[model samples]
Target chain A: MSTSPVTARLDRGVPRFGGFKLAIVRLEIRRQLRNRRTVFFTVAFPVFFFLIFGLNNAYASDPIGRGNESAFIMISMALYGTVLATSNGGATVSVERLSGWSRQLRITPLQPSAYIAIKMATSLVLGLVAILSVYIVAAFTHKPSMPLGLWFATGAAIWIGSLLFTAFGLFIGYLLPSENVMQLIGFALMLFSFGGGLFIPLSQFSHPLRVLATYTPLYGLNQLVHYPLVQGSFNWSWLSNLVSWLIIFTVGATWRFKRDTARV
Target chain B: MAERDVVPRTPPALELKGVRKDFGDVHAVRGIDLRIEPGEIVAFLGPNGAGKTTTIDMMLGLSVPSAGTVSVYGRTPLDAVRLGLVSAVMQSGGLLKDLTVAETVEYTAHLFTGARPVDEVMERAGISLIADRLVAKCSGGEQQRLRFAMALLPDPDLLLLDEPTQGMDVEGRRAFWKAIRHDAQAGRTIVFATHYLDEADAYADRVVLIREGEIVADGSAAEVKALASGRAVRATLFGADQATLRALPGVDHVEVHANSILLHCADSDAVARYLLTQTNAKDIEITARALEDAFVALTGSHARDESVQSNADEVLR
Candidate 1:
């Protein structure tokens, strides 16, 4: 056997960051965008909810916080959109796991950290798209009355806060089988959104339910994102909730990923 | 100067020392010890459930062994793989169904440090024409070729193909092997697992026959074929005593069916000559035992053991 021109120049060093990792993120984004179901649920659903819930005059007539009720609903809907986008993006890992793509990746030069980074990066990108789309719709139609800085701050907060759900999605994607992943994620998302005051204000919940709502994973993210528009100050509970859930989900995701990839 | 002098030789391409794998109660691979030298094209010849895929998975570091070690080029399997020293075309379920052929190739190419140019690899795999086709729309053979192209991306020194041509048509299989042969000629150490004896015989420099998770035979095609108790000579002879024919030189066993005598012989040529000159034998036929028969003969012992265990249970009951 003789060496070929291609084999002669084989590079043996470990690759630097940003080459293959960025390619993986780009490919993941392209593939996710191609899935109409993902787009509809992540981007379109929250916008649709905003149109239905935000158009009413009752919330606008009654001032709830720093802004009016329309502003509150808009921020909640955007947060919901980001949550959906990031969670769905993370959940796609279940399909990839089932398809043995993770196994294929294990045999490659690409580091496991790089693969996780790619997934997180992709989820963040999709979350950005979801947040911006909802915010754009609200800016045009609902015209929620708020200072321009607060609006951008709220959007940034929601986008950043969705990282917890992204980790949550990763935890479940690696923990659950592919067949049960979407159903579980959908049910969990509905419950979290309701409890977190994304769909309904926590003030409207019964005393016991409102207590439980504070403990839900999304509660902290919801409060954090709405703080700028509603409170204009940080709530210690909101910061603690977000930090605690982030740590839990990140640890769970890392453990599950290691266990899943280590299996024969 | 010789080519070997021009380049320093590396360690063995692959080495498995007392490798074992267990899936709960079922021991998929009992213990396998193998050393494959660099530039050797070895075929892991085995039937389904004979641990070929498991062995390949362990070698590729897709699965960790229950015990012992597997190394490629003296590095741990995973380390070797990460260094782009080894690559594999797995049997199935490794590909993304959504990506187009070209996208898949390009995407995988980007994951490696020194992948071959995408278009060159596509052309080499004979998938250039179908580059625009979605992976889900490609045929089984096309998907295999796509996997082949991915394996070639890193220009890996050692290529592991797990039942690479499992579902290909005859022509597709021929072309697949042609491309593999091209790789082999370019100094790649190729290890492919296959149930097809002819594939091992034709394409591999050495054939390692595995049965019930252990290597039953390891040698060249002819050498492995010789592991089965030799060839059979059939001849028409009237009123010939089976006992007398069984006692002939080179003959191991004899079966008489009507007027024809079947002699299982270590040396079929000697038996044939004896049958032609001394005996009133006619219409003689000598057939070497096919690898299929050898495989059955090798694995049949397990079936026999199970039956014996069942018989003992019945007696106890």
Candidate 2:
């Protein structure tokens, strides 16, 4: 066979990654947004939780921290946004892996970094969409006022918080058999929302569980984002906590993924 | 083409050397050694639990090999994507069923620079007509064809197809093979797996039969069939006696009835000579070895006996 055509093709040079990753990101966003289920779970679920909890606290007349319950719920809502991102994103990855879609991608010229980038980007978009929905709801119903700096801080925290926990979620989904992903996601969400005060305030929990929440990613996000939203100050300890957990999840997840899928 | 005009290419299109995959203690692929040149169609044939999928998985770098190495274009299969080489139509459906056929194919094509145009690939795969429809809305056969379109959109030099026609109707299968043959003739290397012996016999330049984690036979259709080393003779002889037919030399087995006889022999000429000597012989015909028969024989007498036993049991029940 002649090599001329192949040589010509090869000589065209390698593709740039910028457009490829963007395309993957676009595709991922399209797939999730187009699905009514995904939109409901990732975008609408957090809003529903916010309204339910906010309405209940509104009747207290003097909600926790002097009618500052709106600020507190805003932070909790961001944490719930992280949970939404991790659960939905991890589920997507798990389904793709189980159905051999990831295997199919390995054969294409789609770089692994590009693929992972799109997934992380997808998680960020989910987090962003969820947080934005809460922002809209809080403005109309809760009537919470915040400086632009705090809003930026909240958004940044949500993005990083989603990245950290979504990595953890991905690690669990990738390492565990596909059949167990949904069960694990449900369990993890329960732990975060009820035990770590993602929907309710941590003060409502008993002492030991509240202490345990201090070490969880959800607690770190709540503390980090809540400080700026409620007290109008950035907590350095919260930053340390969030970054530490991000390092742990990223390193641990990357290592586990490599060990599980590495080629001999 | 002058030799001087061609650049020296050091690596084969794909190679699997001593590759093995183990899922817990069960060895899926024991030790596979395969080399596909620049442009060749290699068919992998095996029964269930015969490591064909595992081997293809290793070659595509989906599952890590328990031992040895797999390389494509001198790079490991893990890194083949970086080299913009090799593509596959996996046994599992990988397309997002919610997307249109064109969307899936375009998404796949966008993964590589210099990929074939989406329309061209769809045309080549005979799926251009269904380009606008959602993948899930397509018929099973059309979905399979669209999968081929996605796999081929990159104009990958090496294509791996696992049971490409598993659900296709006759016409779909024929159309699929037509596209594959055109690709083969255009110098695209392919490794296809199928249970259909005729597909392998008709399309593949070489067929490799794998069994129990090892390659049992590898050759052209006729060459593999010849491994059985026997000829079949069936005759409806009016005056031949069963006992007399059994007495013929070199005949391994003989079944006789009132008007016909079936003889199994390793040598056709010897059987012909014996039949000619029979004065009562009225009708005789010799048949060439068939791939199906060769496959059954190569798999061993136990398998054949089990098949026979099952048929008999079915009839009796």
Q: What does DockQ give for each predicted structure?
A: 0.37, 0.39
Residue A170 in candidate 1, Cα distance off native in Å: 0.6
Computed on alpha carbons, the lDDT of every model, listed in order, comes to: 0.84, 0.72
Chain B TM-score for the candidates in order: 0.74, 0.73
- Candidate 2 lDDT over residue span A5-57, tens digit each: 33214643456773365676677777777768667766677778767765564
Clashing pairs for model 2 are none
Q: Quote each prediction's TM-score.
A: 0.83, 0.77
- Report the C-alpha lDDT of model 1 over B39-79, residue by residue, as the tens digit: 89999988888899999989988788999999887777877
Q: Worst ten-residue run, lDDT, model 1 chain B?
A: B1-10
Top candidate on TM-score is 1
lDDT of 2 by residue, B1-317 (tens): 59658876656777788988888889888898988787778889776678888888877877788888888877777556555577788775686766788888877777777778989989988999989998779887788888888877667778889988887777788888898787677788899987666777899888898877898789987766555466778876777776776676657678877788888777777777777774556467887556345466445544565689899999999
> How does the DockQ of candidate 1 come out?
0.37
